[model samples]
Target: MATAPPPKSQHVGAAVAEKATSHVAQYSPDEKWAERSRKAMQDAITNPPADAYAGRSVKNTGNLAIAFRSLNEILVRNKVRQTVRMTERHEKKGTKRRRLQSERWRKQFSNEVRKKVQLVIKIRNRGA
Candidate 1:
């Protein structure tokens, strides 16, 4: 006698599991950093402070240094605060060093944010 085919539910479940496994396998450290950097750049551009580049001519003085500093400070503070909140939510899970390291990473990430803002300023000035 011929054997019957597997159930439809089994096929669907296998396909779903394979898809989920493939997604997880496709993840890489580089992709993660790229996504994070893209997000930081977008955030920096979208929520620029009201006083960004204030009291200085972009063409002449090009107060990019001051603007970068201000933007970096804001970004770093926000990132650190977010990290702290997340750690608090997951309290008793991570070590103190892990928390400190996360804060340090957030601070370093702010430098990238500053660089992004500077690049935008340069492009805008060039276009003007």
Candidate 2:
């Protein structure tokens, strides 16, 4: 006797999985970045700084800069080399020209941020 075909539910489930995987594969670089940013924001909001810094709450304020600063401070206290990158812009006093001076502003990141990013990836991969 011939075996019976798979149930309709199995086919539907396979199709849903294919669609979901295809959607993920089609995410653009910007979309991926936005997704990561959102996750980081959520993590920051969930885990607030322990000490009160100038009575400012990184979570409540919804400021990524402040959250980064807090994370950097924690890394510093723990003697971690990974730090957040920061950049500043300044206008020179002269003719009708504006130029950024290297000495005036710099973009820098420590090894701690990398570690943190890796941790985030691990957490995401584990479906947590």
TM values, all candidates: 0.27, 0.23
Location of the lowest summed lDDT over 10 successive residues in candidate 1: 52-61
Range of the 10 consecutive residues with the lowest summed lDDT in candidate 2? 82-91
List, in order, the clash count of every candidate structure.
0, 4
lDDT of 2 at 98: 28
User: What pairs collide in candidate 1?
Assistant: none
Best model number under lDDT = 1
Superposed model 2: Cα runs more than 4 Å off? 1-12, 18-25, 52-128
Q: Write the per-residue lDDT of candidate 2 for residues 8-56, one digit (tens) a residue.
A: 6678788898778885667789999999999999998988757745333
The residue-by-residue lDDT of candidate 1 on 1-128, one tens digit each, is: 99898886778888898778885756598999999999999998987766734433233257878776766676575575576676675555467678789979998999999999999999999996
Local lDDT at 114 for model 1 = 99
Instruction: Assess each prediction's global lDDT (C-alpha) against the native.
Output: 0.75, 0.66
Position 54, candidate 1: lDDT: 49
